[model samples]
Target: MTNILFVCTGNTCRSPMAQAIMQHRSEWNVQSAGIFAGEGADASQGTKEVLHAKGIPFLHQSQPVTDSLLEWADLVLTMTQNHRDLLKQQYQAATNKIYALKEYIDPDYEQAWTELKEAYAQLEDQKLVGKEMQADVIRKINKLEKKVQNVDISDPFGGNIMTYQKTYEELDNYLAQLVKKMENENR
Candidate 1:
């Protein structure tokens, strides 16, 4: 199973919502963390209310992101680009598998995947390609990657209950879509 790690600032808000949503929804193994060390983090009342409204079970434990979690994750999905940047800079070795959660939910996934496959094949071609051609191909693939990237999900950390509920809805929706994609890929 693919192991997914969702991250946010405090773990009380965004990351917990994502963790709960993805854990129950996706076929993949899902976990969550906060950039800051949350020693006594419990789910906020707003968070709890929203989850209870949706009938999502709550398991409370607040842990800061650790090297072990980074190493264990197959993919790390941050709530925002800033969070991704922070994680990448701190854990450069794991940058290869990190992304923003909404970043992968693009409408042009098929086209983007096709281009990525072609780029990988070019890199592996038995016949040697000239250095310039290889560089050009690499640049093109990177551009395509940006085009298909998911937009960073917003943080509703200090917002009211309505805001938390809205955020929960968005998280749940995207996670359900992710689960569907995983199922199709496995089939």
Candidate 2:
């Protein structure tokens, strides 16, 4: 079974929800982490409520992204472009494997991925924090911005139930496509 890791900033909201939705839809061994997750933190109430409403009895504890987990995931799916770049910077080996969720589901992801890989290659990790390393990656991310608006899942933390519901619907739609993609990949 494929091991898929979903990622977000805090792991309280978006990534946990993505993990639940994807795990429910696919046969893959699914997990989630945060770029800066607090160990053993509870999943957000919004995430819990959304999944409960969907009848997915899910519980998640926040785990910080680590070398072991990076090695564990066959595919590392991030909730935002920032997370994607951060991961690739920290774990260069996974650069080829990581993708923003929207990019993975894009009809032209193959081309997008190739171009993104190229852009990522141009980045120098130490220079990324400053604007110096950004010219190329910025251009690529900007092109993606035109093709996919709100490619990052909106953070629903501190929002009301309706907000979380909307985020859930959006993620669920992409996740369905992701499940199909995984099935096709396996075939």
Give the candidate number with the greatest TM-score: 2
- Model 2 lDDT vs. the true structure? 0.87
lDDT of 2 by residue, 54-166 (tens): 99878889999999999999999999989998999999988989999988888875666566666666664445665754765788767864665546878898999999999
| TM-score list, all predictions | 0.75, 0.81
Local distance difference test scores for all models: 0.82, 0.87
Error of 1 at 2 (Å): 1.9
Taking all chains together, the TM-score of candidate 1 against the true structure is 0.75
lDDT of 1 at 25: 71
Q: Across residues 1-187, which tens digit of lDDT does each residue of candidate 1 receive? A: 8899899988888888898877677567888899994766797788888988888898867789999999899889888878988999999999998877776665576588789888878777835468888888889878877765556776787899999988988888888777777677779
Candidate achieving the largest lDDT: 2
Q: After superposition on all CA atoms, what RMSD does each candidate show versus the true structure?
A: 6.7, 7.3
For all candidates, the clash counts are 2, 0
